[model samples]
Target: MQFLEDPVLWIAEWLREVLLGWGASELVTNMTLNFLGAFVVGAMIMVIFILLTWIERKAAARFQDRIGPNRVGPFGLIQPIADAVKMLTKEDTRPKGADVVGYVLAPIVSVFSVLMTWAVVPFTQKWIGADLSVGVMYVAAAGSFGIVAVLLAGWSSNNKYSLIGAFRGVAQLISYEVPLFLSLLVPVFLARSMGVNDIITSQTAVLFAIPWLNIPIRGFFVLAAPLSVVIYFISSLAEVGRAPFDLIEAESELVAGYHVEYSGMKFGLFQAAEFLHSFTFAALMALMFFGGWQGPWVGTNNLTGWLLGGFYFMLKTFFFYMMVMWSRLTFPRIRIDQMMNLNWKFMVPVSLVLLMGMPLIDYGLRGQELWLKYLVLFLFNLIVGLIAFAWAARADRRVKTHTRVRFEGRPVAVMPQAPAAAEDETAG
Candidate 1:
């Protein structure tokens, strides 16, 4: 498995060798290498954060059948550059009576929390900044920090709308974390390790190739625990404040949500964090469920392999980002209550059951053939789905009027008039 050697490690080793061979001190050489790695990772994540602004706009344009940013540059690739300039030059205005400290800290907290998760993510075998044994737990913890930022922004803004939005955000974030963490436990349980690198290594073998039938298989932990993947993905969308679950930022009600009092890059930074988190969420899903950095013969050398590894990671990441874009364009936003009910009433229970059941099934079927093992796991998923459907049907009868709550105080509402002939008949 020398082919699996981390490119980053090899490069650092080569640097160390050259430095030592030149009579340089070991401490200095090691320090230099660590600094270089940190610079590269930080720079890469920030650059992507800027580019994703354009990427999401372009993706949304395509979905809506509109010309996205063709005017700025070819396919509007430089559109984000223009927007960045605008945001930087704009006035940083603070609303009167706003808390200076928390208002400023909110954007920094929001952006940093999401960016820091990249430290433990393995782009290649050796590319990670840290390989902490509790990497998954670290990620889950980091992901929740955005909620703190939201609360700060809302409370500090001294705006009623901001506070309302912040409370809504708190509810959504608190509700989703349950399912998100529960789903995350599946991979941890199966890999028998919490380290992201170890989890990646455990998935090195074929996912599902049948010897008798000659059917090829493609899987990582995602295939073994498909329910977890489903729940995690849905929860992640909510976590990032995407549509259908974005009631936290319900513009129709909250008027720009928690950061309503901020202007200039401060406002821009909060917006960037939201979109950036969405992309990061997709990347994490790819790494967790899609055999991250595993691709066919990407590079022959350690250096080239590292390049290839980063490529595969980005490709897989953008694929999920596209899925997120599609989901946003397709679904209408649900009311706050519906959003809560969907998460707490449905997703939380289903995800809990899946998490509890997977280990039992795997242990009980340890001696059985691989196919039989999978069959039992799949049956378990099917039963959970049916249970969800039945519960939903029963819920429908109980909360049939739930959806109309959002329209309770409609103002400036106008009813459309029929065609001339229809209108004339109605008058007659």
Candidate 2:
């Protein structure tokens, strides 16, 4: 009670002093400045999302060997704006049998959920919306609202395909959430706190005046265990419903899937929510695995820290986002059965092993020689990876052989007819 008391008064007093020192007014001027700062940050995040959509489309087009939106503006930079205008002007449609309220509200729910999640994410040391102690858990909880919205969209549409897509979306997200949590637990455990700021602070290198072989090495989770980084990335991709994990929106099978009945700006809102969600997850992953707002040579100054850290963070997130896009363009979408099997058979087991092994490895490396730990981790990864590859190859060979059928009957070949020009010339 004592510790929590007078927090507002303390902040006000500190602000009053700072304002007086700067030759400004007590309360109104400081409040106005704070509000302006928050508004600018929010606006910047929105702008980043718009640019991200353009970048994604351009990247996808380049991957498929085609020119993407070059007519709207320079390199089609204004394509997203045009798309927004078109969606806004288009006729809104609702199917006759659809549930009117839920059908209309679902997209708004999804977009609102996505935007709310952004409030907890810190852009810099000083520039964050809420900065709650439970920031990470807040994000996780808020993200699940999209699942509710998707399910509502599907069920209220009165479409079988939409319902099936919604089911797929829920199942995939739930299954992948397990691995995501497990992988994320590594960082949280190391940080010793669930707060996002604490996790970032924990990434600083430990410096001691004494040199000893048994000294604990402090660094980012990515440096400590690269496997968790990989697992988190893969799980996040599945969470976002990107291919080859995108069975939820399988166009050939489900005809636009859960959003089948949505039209005009409503449908556009759903699409925008999806892209925004993906961007948010990518940023979260960047903060977790890569150093959040921490750069190599730059110290945490207000402007430089925000820009450089944000730049590095965006660069890392965009790289992963492009990888997701590449997989979407390069690989075929898996069947529903294959998708479930992957979660149950491969990702679940691998994530479990990693979850258990990471702590044990950390314990073993705590006081042991560095070279010995490296050697053991390397050997273990190499052996397991080889066995997994071999098993996959053998399974693939068996599948090919089982699917191949030999025809016993004699082959009958049809020859092409001779050209009419040859007959005409002979006749002439």
Best by lDDT: 1
Tens digits of per-residue lDDT for model 1, 1-428: 24346645667778899989998898988898888887898788889878888878888888899878888878778889999999999999988899999999999999888888888988876578999999999998897788899999999999999999999898889889889888888888878899988887776655466889866564477767777788899999999888978888888988888888888999888987888888888888888877788776655357556878778888999999889888998999999877888888889889888888888999998877666766777788778878887988898876777757856777756666668769899999
Q: Relative to the true structure, how large is the alpha-carbon lDDT of every model?
A: 0.84, 0.75
Write candidate 2's Cα lDDT for 273-348 as tens digits: 8877778877787777666766654356544666666677677777777777777678878888777766666666
Error at 25, model 1, angstroms? 4.9
Tell me each candidate's RMSD, in Å, in order. 6.3, 8.3
Of candidate 1, the 10-residue stretch with the lowest lDDT total is 1-10
**Lowest summed lDDT window (length 10), candidate 2:** 1-10
Residue 54 Cα positional deviation in candidate 2, in Å, after optimal superposition:
1.2
Clashing pairs in 2: none
